[model samples]
Target: MVKLDGISSFVAIAEAGSISAAARRLHLSKSVVSERLAELEQHLGAPLFHRTTRKLSLTEDGSAFLERANRIVWEVQDAVAEVAERRGSLSGPMRLSAPVTFGRMHLGPALYPFLARHPGISLTLELDDRRIDAAAEGYDAVIRHGTVEDSRLVALPLAPSRRLLVAAPDYLARHGRPDSLAALRQHRAIYYTNRNVADWRFADVRQDVFVRPPAALRVNNGDMMRDAALAGLGLALLPSFIVGEELRAGKLVRLDIGHEAAQELIYVAHPEGRRASHKLRTLVSTLREHFGTPPYWDVV
Candidate 1:
């Protein structure tokens, strides 16, 4: 295989206009640069330069090869930068995907400080409610909720996904709040369409219980669901982070159910072997730090 060193030397010599000039720029002896050029030319079976004391210029084959050589050199430099970023100092673009609701409510606040701290990194945040293939979709990392089924991904837990059954005070007054799990059947439901089929799960002492509430209105986004609850449409099970502000403002009321709500897991997933990248590691750490144990949003 033709070595990258030779290709890089060829590119430098072509750009610098002579092996001697390239040697000066590279801090190498002219002889070494000439030898590298000769080796590359030998490997390709072509004379890359029209050499004379007066001037140096590229031949036809050399012109075509120079383009590829330049690209190769650039690729080599980029690879070095990528490795360097993973080792310590951070730079380059970081592509991240996340669920719309959690990202806006939680990750959005945390990201500002992280970006401020690392000015070298350019971040792209893509928000989608549907689960995407992290590797196939070309994301550096993704924020996901509940059980991470993709064994190909490495996960870092960000927070506990605690959902609250809530409704507007007007709805509760008009419809009457259910005091227990069984009473939920009597309530009209505003469903988050993205939720699991056996959606409502709760804790009853050491065991678990599941309920599928009948849906009066179904929507894909959490913010819309929160709006529905605030509009007094019906009772909805919403993640704490999305409804924290509404709950705190007394626009929505959390029912004191007889059993504990089952907790789900929130994770940041990356393609396997990607956890070591400084960009991914730093982002995950920042999110973990922001969320903490019970998470600030869940305190209410």
Candidate 2:
């Protein structure tokens, strides 16, 4: 009989690309993971991976086995979740990833109450700005802002995020406020390098415009961009969640350039093939409820 533990370890190894990565995800020693894989391979009388000094690649058999392995692991999780649901309790680990700024400012606070309600569930939250392969990384859910084009994943919309051109009152006083998109191009702009498009795009009923102002400062994080704008460094195109409070308090002023800035949707996504456990569903619902229609951050 194939041991379920061996099958699970195989699935983790296949998805994670390396045993070391899989070990980290599974919270197991490398030796233990290796042993499990070796045992499984022996039972099947076939090598699962082509080992190399640089990397590990799945063998033909390993490639064929991965889909079935994922199904088996998901089915087991669902079985356990079914029983837990009947008992009115949730127990297991939920691994999640989100952008560093949003995770720290919003997602963390939103998750606290959910954690409080389900004391039986263990939580692992990773705050990262880079896009992640959720299945390979073994995340239960990934909170992302922007377009989710991965058809392999099921995306559940959390909230709407809009970007606005903003600057501090002092900065505007020093540099003069931009009355039009043309005037905006002459001023120093704070550029967020992490986004795919360097140019800012805006649209209205009448027309669409793209602006690429000269960069006074280039930053990878939204909070830093907001800070630069707050410190009178330069005008920044920043998301509402980052600058909404400052905008409301008059610390930062929004530029009315006729066209509305780009809007992106925030989503909590998981692999489509992965079965949603009771805990995962409840957490998604909790986040949606917590953020509300316009999101608490966008009230301004």
Candidate 3:
């Protein structure tokens, strides 16, 4: 029989793309990982990897076996988790990813309390703005903004995120307030470069409007955009979660151009077909409870 440890090492090596990297991820010595791989290959009478000086890749047999290997590992883990749950506790690794701003400002706080409640749970959180392949990256869950397009994942809504057109009082004083969509197009705007930087979309009861405003600054980060707006650089279109505190504190004022900016939902998503471990379910529940319906940040 193939040992589970050998199979796990194979999966790790395949995902990580290198033996040294896999060894580091598994917290095992390179020799130990190599030994496991060698033993598994001997048992199967087939080599699993295409070893090279510059790169490592899976062989045809390895490619064919990968999906089944992943399923086996997950099944074993889920089985262990179910047993642990019946004992009134959970124990496992939970890997997650979220946008940098949300992770720092909100998700960190929400997760820490959950971690405190379940000390046996090992957590790995990656904060990045770029889109990721959830299963390929080995993340148990990912927090996403806007719509989830991948049908292979299950999205659980955490909160409603509404975008608002906003500016500092000082900026309005200098540039004058824009009362209509036409007037708003004439003002300097801070552009979030990650999205379409040239166009701003708005909707009213009767119609939708799109405007192209001259950019005063283009930035990739939401926190920086919020800061630029606060510094009276220019108008900014930002999500409520990022600027809600500033809006409430009178540092930033929402612009009413007779149309509302687009709205989206925050979601905690996981792979579709896999059975969610008890710890993952518990984390999702904690996040849902913490964010509430409208989210604490959006409460007026």
Best by TM-score: 2
Reference-based lDDT, residue 259, model 3: 80
Deviation in Å, model 1, residue 159 alpha carbon: 1.7
lDDT by residue (tens digit), candidate 3, 274-296: 87778988888899999887688
How well is each residue in 1-300 modelled by candidate 1, as lDDT tens digits? 788889878877876777787787566999998898889889999999999997789999999997777667656656765887767667776778989988887888999999998888888889999878876455668888777788999888888888888999999889897997778878888876676665666775332444545788998898999999999989888888888889899999999878756778889887774434666787888988888987888877
What lDDT does each candidate get? Answer: 0.81, 0.87, 0.86
Give candidates' CA RMSD values in order. Answer: 12.8, 1.9, 2.4
- Tell me the deviation in Å of residue 206 in model 3: 13
* TM-score head-to-head 2 vs 3, winner: 2
Please count the clashing residue pairs in each candidate, in the order shown. 0, 0, 0
For residues 1-300, write the lDDT of model 2, one tens digit per residue: 789999999998888889999899899999999999999999999999999998999999999988898899989988888888899999888889999999989998999988998898999999988788898778888999877778879998999988889999999999899978788877999987867653476765323445567889988788899999999998998889999999999999999977787678899899987777789888888989999997988876
User: How much RMSD separates candidate 2 from the native structure?
Assistant: 1.9
Residue 177 lDDT (model 1): 79
- The 10 consecutive residues of candidate 1 with the worst lDDT sum are 204-213
In model 1, state the lDDT of residue 225: 90
